[model samples]
Target: MALLPVDDALQLILADARPIADIEHVPLHEAWGRIVAEPLIAMRDQPPFAASAMDGYAVVAADTAEPGATLRVVGESAAGHGFTGAIGRGETVRIFTGAPVPQGADAILIQENARPLETTMIGVVEPVQAGRFVRRAGLDFHRGETVIAKGAMLDAGRLTLAAAMNLPALPMHRRPRVAILATGDELVPPGADPRDDQIIASNSFGVAAIVKEAGGEPIDLGIAADTLAALNRSIDAAQAAGADILVTLGGASVGDHDLVRKVLESRGLELAFWKIAMRPGKPLMSGRIGPMHVLGLPGNPVSSLVCSHVFLTPLIAKLVGRTHHVQAVDAILDVDLAENDLRQDYLRAAMHRRPDGTLVATPATRQDSSMMRVFAEADGLVVRPPFAPEAKAGDAVRAILLRHI
Candidate 1:
């Protein structure tokens, strides 16, 4: 099949993906990063009653219209111990912040604005308007109102609001479970002794980190040899774990040693599309086995990581009901770039800001897909369109940032 464009490949991958239907009740403390499965209704008014917003005297606003007006201190209202008696004309109640405002009191005369005339009398030096320093009932939210909408991610602010709404727990969507499997006879587990031609496997670790950051649970299926039996065993393990997505590293290309596609097809895998028209990730393959999605990525460390950021992240975000977008912003090129290729390029580049706040991107001299160290030091990927003309320095370009810088 002809290679699919990068955007077209992504569209096909996400077209049928939907948010997880299973909802789990998570405590407010543990709900962070989870997607709300339903609208959160307030159990009661944020403040059950009209309350004081300041430590002051609650009095009739009409009675405190003039300066030096003295009122009898009838009672004290403190948090959790409110004054039950109503305030009459020429009477005031000593009220602390968060205390229920006494009935018949329309305003609060703050302590700084009041002068003590006697033990039971205080002068209103500054007259307070009605409702001043008073937090009306349901000021924050009303009972039975939807305070948090469905599909909202629980962050610090949202969690705090949920707590104040009297919600101790939230209904959240179950995070997607991803199974990672590394393939190839030349690969071994990290820290393991390897033969002359064998290399340590490192792609699964980076892929797992991406999955976690995208709010998906990653299950390591360990490394599988190039043989069909090993691949079939790992695939069985992934299905046993109920993984929503199975990610296979290496053996995606049409070579004699490539067995991922062959094994997946034998197990009833429905092929979607294979190979993208993009550099460092042209061998990318996406398909489905029953209900599980399968993504075959290139063996190169940098290629695997880039594909994860470009594809897997969005798939996980979709399954969790979280909004995800890969933003490519305009930047100035710091060096000349060769052009004209059938495949799109994602050049690892360093980003910096000029004195005038203009962003400048400088791609590394060597952009080999196998070099993991260069990818790590890169701040972003300088995107070059397929078949674009050669460009000189200082030309405006576009980049997808990977780091804060």
Candidate 2:
């Protein structure tokens, strides 16, 4: 049978994905990067009282009609303290920034615009207008008003807003949990002394990083020996951990040692599809086991990372209610091209900003699947359609940027 298209596979992977319904009460200072579960209302008006915005005289505007107008200084007002008496005609209060504007004062006369005549008197050197340099009550926000909408991501700015609203704790959606398992008897974790034929396992680290970056909590299950019993034990642990998504690396393709698909199926996993029509990651498996979504990735280093960028990140975004996605853009090819076949191609490539401000992508000479170094140094993946025609250098192409260069 032909392989499933990339778009179709993504739709299947995300079909059942839904934002978690559980709500958590997170402290205001620790609510960053969480999704708001309910609308955040202001508890009190920002700047509860009319405040002085400058370190100068809080005056009745009519007292400072023109330059050099004399006014008697009544009392002093500093931050967190207010003048008890009201300001009358031809009288002003010595006020500091953030101090409550005294009653009957309509404006502030900055010190630069006023000359001190004595400890209790000053001459206005500039005209003072009503409501100038005075922060009115409720100017920023009002009591019982909605400050943040539901489903909004609690970024740094939003967290500051929540604090200003007097919110001690915020209602947030629970974070999605992802469990990752790596298979193959030849694989070992880093820093371990490996035997002659064994190699360090790396796919799980990359996969877990992708999950965390996409706003999910990743629980590493370590490497499971290539046996059905070991695999079953790992599966049991993942389910017991209450993981919402389970990701398994290697053993996805049909091989003598590949037993992941068979074991999962025997445990009642509903296999959605086995493969996709994409190069660098064709033998991709997607299915569901009970309430947990499963993604079986290819063993090749480049293939696993590419698939994670294409599928795993999107699934995590859907589960957390995030709206942004990695986007593909048109670019110029800086090297010669060749014709393609049935599978869509994602070639690791370096990108350059040309003198004319155009972005150019040049594919690596060797497009091997196991080369982890290539993917590391690559700025993007140069995309080629199936059955694409041969092309020359400087031709227009499309690429998905891994990160900003």
TM-score of each: 0.94, 0.93
Q: Residue-wise lDDT of candidate 1 within 221-242, one digit each (tens)?
A: 9999989999999999999999
Task: Please list the residue runs of candidate 1 whose C-alpha ends up more than 4 Å from where it truly belongs after superposition.
Answer: none
Most accurate candidate by lDDT: 1
Could you give me the TM-score of model 2 versus the true structure? 0.93
The sequence of per-residue lDDT tens digits that candidate 2 reaches over residues 1-405 is 788888899999998888888888999887888889999999999989999999999998988886678999989999988998898999999999999999999999999998989989999899889999999999999999998999999889999989999999999888888999999999999999999999999988888888877778899999999899999999999999999989999998888999999889988899999889999999999989988999999998889999999999999888877765677877889889999888889999999897888999999999899999999899999988888999799899989998885
- The deviation in Å at residue 258 for candidate 1 is 1.9
Q: Could you say which candidate leads in TM-score? A: 1
- How much lDDT does each candidate structure score? 0.93, 0.91
Candidate 2: give the clashing pairs: none
